[model samples]
Target chain A: MASMANQGAPERRPGIPGTPGGQPRGRGLSMRTRQLFWVWGFLALPVLFYGVIRFYPTLNAFWLSLTDWDLMSEPEFIGIDNYTRMFSDPEFWKVFRNTFTYLIVGTPISLVLSFLIAFALDRIRFGHTFLRALYFLPYITTASAMAWVWRWFYQPAPIGFINDLLGRVGIPQMAFLNSTTWALPSIMVTAIWAGLGFQIIIFMAGLRAIPTTYYEAARIDGLGEASILRRITLPLLKPTTVFLVVFSSIGFLRIFDQVYNMTTNDPGGPLGSTKPLVLMIYQTAFSSYEMGYAAAQTVVLFTILLCVSLLQLWLLRER
Target chain B: MRTQILMAGLLAGTSLVAGTAAQAVEIEYWQYVYETRVTAMDQLIDAFEAANPDITVKQVTFPYADYQTRVVAANMARKGPDVLQMFYGWTDQFVGGKVIQPLSPEVFPHDEIEAEFFPIVTAMKRGDDYYGLPTAVRSLALFYNKDLMTKAGLDPENPPKTLDEMVAAAKAMTEMDAGGNLSTAGMTLDMGGQDHQWWREVLVRQFGGEPYSADYSQVTYNDAAGAAALKFYTDLQLVEKVGQRGFMDEGQAAFRAGRAGLTIDGTFRLGSFSSIEDFEWGVTELPANAEGVRSNYASYFANGIGIGAEGEELAAAEKFLAYISSPEAMKIWLDVVGELPARRDVALTEENLADPIYAPFLKGLDYAKTTLFIDEAAQRQNAIDMANRILIDGQSVEESLAQAAEAEQAIIDKAK
Candidate 1:
């Protein structure tokens, strides 16, 4: 790059006006060349890794989505046949709805739940670290293990903790993951719980970034708690909210582990009520061995992710 | 001088070891994760290696759920196992994709496969070649809780013999709490697992029809017989209300826990049932419908060599497979895994047939349906949806079954 800059036109700088040996251009050029060489040398491995494992596959997925390969044969270009199949399939639409249900409902519920916990935790001085660590535990736990624990929690009375509690309180037995109406919401609760710790930590960090003087200032001005939060704290927390909204929205959009693990017996079950797009993609690619179709669904998922993230950032953007 | 001689002998021994190491052929054998399976595989590999010092078998496993995915990915990278255990239904897709090898006559002769293995296991045959060979076979039977039956005032000795009798027994046995919810379910009908087999194999056959055409090109389970079959299952849940799925989270678990009076499950449950000392249970033939017919669904895991394998690796895989199908290996598999032998000679041995536990599964083999669907995943999902629609959505039996049949036909049509 330094050589390219030199090739275009040699820069004849003023050389710091009165400076004698202001690092002569040739020596400086070679020095810059040496730094760039080492910088790229350090970067080359990761660059090649991303090219082979990440970027190449991603780019190939775009092209593969237009073909009709089963991964065992030569990919024959079908010119949007895969996309047509995906759009026309009823299973795709069901998965699309289920995915949006997770994103639209899961994101707001998780953000608010985590934020409230974080806010309450930030106010507590005693056992604050212990409590925060307790809340952050799920974040580090393996998702499959956490999902199975929640699955046990959702079981019927005498076995499941949740139903047992409900039964003791004299409520009718509710089908947690069995009913079509309840399965998606049930999966969402586990997903939100699994992701809550990380969200709370992030929210706490955002909470700490706000200056305490502002709260003290609002108190002096006789602002109520709600008023102080609305006028001073929330506005300052706009950047954090935007970041979380986008981050959590993407998480919900690409949800697979929770749905896959929670309903391990028949994942995305009770008539496809809990079948998200990612699970559907996994089924198509691995179970059905339809590479082209899976790639097409991946493209659809990518487009949805792009639009959703952009819309979230725009909606949460500060004026 | 004595120390020099000893050193020279040690050097010669080291050279011999080096020569053996250089000539040994190591072949990977992929199996699904299971305690008994691992033990059985270790025993087989040990025996094979001891018999053939020139070959080595490396055993590896993945979880059953991800086994197919891992195999496909490894095969895609041209580093799949030299030999792998493939589910019977997956053989067509595997061979169609050429991810696994088709056994040549020299590798596995057709007559030998037919003569050695049970006639039913020959379902693995596609066209003229065999894709895999199973060391063991599994068939479904009705697992009943004798204690539950006795508590419900039903005779523990006499189990349900007909569909009507089973319903009567189940309804008689259902125990409800003061809150009016079922406490002990008379039976369990799970959409995710056994419901499909009941609909496709048991009930449909009792109603006098096959689930699919002989060519596997069409769905034949949509006629009056199919509707009647589905209605019988749905009626057991919705109309009779004898069984509630919510009573147990898993399909066969209710019966295993002794909460279910009767549950139709495969022979593989024998291994899981061995630990249930709390309950008195036994297997019986599945009940016939109004027409007095019987049927069962049997599926097996067959080990085969995969693609991109050549030279000594292929030879080693073939050698291991031959050893695996031998009666000695079959005996070890049966003893360790509680599975029936795939080979006719091994399975029909007087001692094996006389074993009390193997009797029911072996009896089922006479009337079991083994389907080799290419798009088995889609078919399974369709069946689950059918169960959900009739049981949960309150859809009519005709409407749901017809819809499921259409969906199944669509999948079959799309399959190559």
Candidate 2:
């Protein structure tokens, strides 16, 4: 995607200066340039839209962080006050830890499960398209409703779906969402469930993109399926792996909706055990009406994401 | 031919735009009442529209929980309603920043009925400036299962007179199964998060301590009286074991189901629990801790019309306000809505106060008080945290009160 953007940049035409033959070629070249200009103009609308709508807000957020601005009052410039308060605020630290836990626990579980499903689906010969769509159904639903459904599913009593299932098997009912010790893990489990469908589809595309000739060539060498997968398939899927890992990590870092909606009994309920960084920022900004502090927290979140993305790129680069 | 075709298309497009353009002055009113009073709102809007002939009133109904956050967001986005329905706790914050316009008591002409409202209604007005008119009132009261008290060898007619007697009766009334596990509880000590702030405030006042002082100027919850209040509330669940510890809504559900002895709630819940046919229930004053300190917290909301902060549609908005607040209009509003009226003359009606279900609330309103603190959300949230800590975490009363006072004072300091 990045390379495609570079290719679209306009370059000056060469090989035409002062010769009589060059004049005819230059006229033809000018006609093509006019055509190219229209194409570029069409593409510029979306590019400019993304720059203004997405990038400008992010830049404004950074500037807003340095000032104490209620949406109503004139902003008073206060350097680092919000950041300093955030450092000392116990609630921020709790939410940060919760978000990190979701990342560490949720990302790997999703990655492994998705890859396994992708590998199996790729090997199946019958109804592969139907099965792929079935597996991908969850990712297509806008997430809030799905998150709410998961919340009811994780209710802290025997009435909860999972608890009822466990109960029918003669196991004791569990307080999945109510107990502080289990709340984050319970939320993470539902998150991984909501998350796995998308990752599987991404990995399946990566698997299908690899040509069968490489596998055929390996089969003739008497290599087993496991050996072929380990040696051939894994080596060729580096770009997809990089994409999934980076995207999944960012998703985990900003896991707000599941935690926010699922545990509403306390607002930041269940002893604030399931509150994430994004939720904390939202509450501070809107509920507490502290826009400056929320802006500062947004900056911190941005820094964390930027650092994580850069680190992943460095770590997963081709050797 | 091409010019004729283009001219035909232009004429049609211009007519379509002109036909669809709106003509009336649009004002939005956001509220929490639904199902119970939507018919009343529609009627009120109909009457207002008929009276004004120029203004259009649009009613936006949201679930009760979503109102504050939605209003705040819309206001920040510069798309807020011209008029809003505000809870008792929200009035101070709205008035503090001058985000809302004040209706002059002089300009408001409903045959000059200012003297007809309770003194508590005047609390809605900040010195020399009134933001809006009072629309409805709610007060907390003690709701008890009469059959259970009788079955436990207690007099069904005699309710507890003081806080100490209330605890003893609860201890005596609590029932357990053979396994010694708690099968039924006597009372719950305001166990829920956030919503229990009103209960905590009433407890503070019952002990002769105010959460904030009378002038709404100072927070006084961490003092000796505050500690006594906290200890009394926590002791019901922790030390006495007469009430359940952590399960708030679950326990309240149980009480509603006739499995518990007592629950403290507001007058609004009468409509919800009116269908319970198994157990005979009755309402009485929420027990006071100190004798002669009969104060209880009032929970009411103000719904009135206001001009947009841009100050454009004052005449149309004021006309609508006047139309809705008339005595005949208030009757239609209250009967369909089930909210107790804010006007003293309307509330004193034989039809409203005559209901036996309203007995406890009317008694509670005798000493009823509204929290006068600014930064109402912060004060409410801190009080909730303090109550939860005392009941669930078993913290000392002094510690809980100290933490609550500190949290609230910080919010107060921030505004300054």
Candidate 3:
């Protein structure tokens, strides 16, 4: 039938019936080609967007790290000088330590807290949906607004709620944002709280995936509650925990908005005690307009993020 | 006959539009958004446009935190506003980068500007060129809670006159619980927020040292005088325990809420202070040094014309600048917004000089200074670190001051 149609229009070049490109016609589409068509049709838009918006600038930043650009005049190529200067700079090292502090401390505390909440939430039957939504509220709130509210809570007596409650309990005032030692941890508590909602929802979904029969069987076998949690619940929760560990680890690594908003008076202040790598990059790029130096800092942040996420995944993998 | 009438109407309309275009020129004015400032600026623009029908002024405002960055980005794209409002400290960077053009010498002769404005304008001038002009200037003054002073059994009418008396007053003003936590602060030390500004601009000079050279070459605040200044300020908390760092929002909120005895803040604070009706507050000059030498911080935001504008656009911007700096605009801004007039004649009137609320700020104008640097933020951060080193770690003020000088000197060097 295809040959008869081609003979009817003999002047026409040999080609697929519907496609614009001239080629020999086929009776049916191959499975791989059809699959690719659907996959690429969906991927093309995001691929174009990432290439234009994300990938190009990322590549440009790699090139810019080797140059001197102040965002005003044309960039000047200066070899490895920016990196050399950054390595020797004391401020850079301080910022590096601060960034890691967020990652190492923030990730585990947030994960454990979210898991506990989700664990308790999954078993509850009365008002379960309301409780779940309440836990998820902070995840949807704007980060800066949340930081400002947390800042108010950290205030001293007569102003800060935490201090007022402490004073009522006969406890002495504990400096929060003011003291260098306490500022980072105080901020971390807020960050973890803000992210707890999303993690809880994911964890609940993971908990729900476990078959009820497993728990019933264990119950019949005379297992205690703690044993069931340790043996079956935790083991099944490994995947959810791993996903959150990597996601929240990256979130903590690039923490900026909270520290920036909280420390607006002197951003990353109280001796730059709370200054993260991202905040430093922001200051370098926007405040000082040292685009080249900022790019170098950004490159360091990228590597740290990449390495930390990979390490967490490797360590958390099933053995 | 009908076609002729249509052609005639079209020609008339075209000429009328062309004539209006030929007569008027437009210039864009950029400022950081403050509610009062935005409102005041709009009023000024409206008045200026009305006065000069041939010129039209457009206003643009950005949030305070991102204004400078926005201006820089706009200029980089060659879309900068014709007129830009920037801080006194930012003048150095703008001048160094040639981001803004100097005031037209024909319109603003050097002598006219010097005679018109206060002595602070001299610092604003680079060599012979005047980079910009302030519509209003702000200086720090002591704002005290009258109710708190009365409770402390001190006279609110008579503020401290000297350093020792200031400390004595603060000590008396403080109230503590049995466990030794402060129930009421005598005064909040600038603390980590903006303590650096107070240190470099006010105390350094009072302690007999210049924070930085007039030429912007070196820092002298690391010497003996600097340590003495830092110790004197920090001693309020460390030795006297008048106010500690643990309090939240201690500076503005503490004073306003009647929990603090005193605070030193900019004249711009008047807008917020005016809203409080429960307690009466008074403004006075900050206490002098033990030697009776007084100084204050006078910071101002000035308007400058950005680069790339020429011909009618630049001329139009100059016209707007001249209008804003005029006595009328200055008075309107001072009344609506709360800074003292930059024009010496306007601020020194008998009515203004006698007004108790604004007079103390006006008195400080003679000895006030702005900390000039390429990047005031970076230099200020150095000051913050120096302060934190002493307050948090119990480090010697002498060592911290020394470290700050080296760090700040490097920042200035990099800007060059």
Interface RMSD of each: 2.0, 4.6, 2.1
lDDT of 2: 0.73
Residue B196 displacement (Å), model 2: 2.7
Winner by TM-score: 3
Model 2 residue B67 lDDT?
Answer: 67
Per-residue accuracy of model 2 over B1-416 as CA lDDT, tens digit each: 99999999999998887665444577777777577666787888998888766678889877776767677666666677777778656666666544567785667642454576656766767776666776667777777889989988888788787777778778877876443434567885544522355445676776667777677667777777778877777777677888754332355566776867877777677777778899898878777665656766776677655334444466566666666666767688667766667677777767656777765676667578776656665555566567666554567789877877887778877776
Q: How well is candidate 1 docked (DockQ)?
A: 0.42
Structural similarity to truth (TM-score) of each candidate: 0.90, 0.81, 0.91
Residue by residue across B107-146, what tens digits does model 1's lDDT show? 7888877877777776778887788889899888877888
Worst 10 residues of 2 chain A by lDDT: A5-14
Q: Candidates sorted by DockQ, descending order?
A: 3, 1, 2
For B139-242, candidate 3 gives per-residue lDDT tens digits of 88888888888888999898888778878888999988765678789987765444567778778888998888877688878888888889988788889888
Best by lDDT: 3
At residue B332, candidate 3 shows an lDDT of: 94
Instruction: Assess the local accuracy of residue A137 in candidate 1 as a C-alpha lDDT between 0 and 100.
Output: 95
- Fnat, one value per model: 0.49, 0.08, 0.59
User: Of the native A-B interface contacts, what share survives in model 2?
Assistant: 0.08
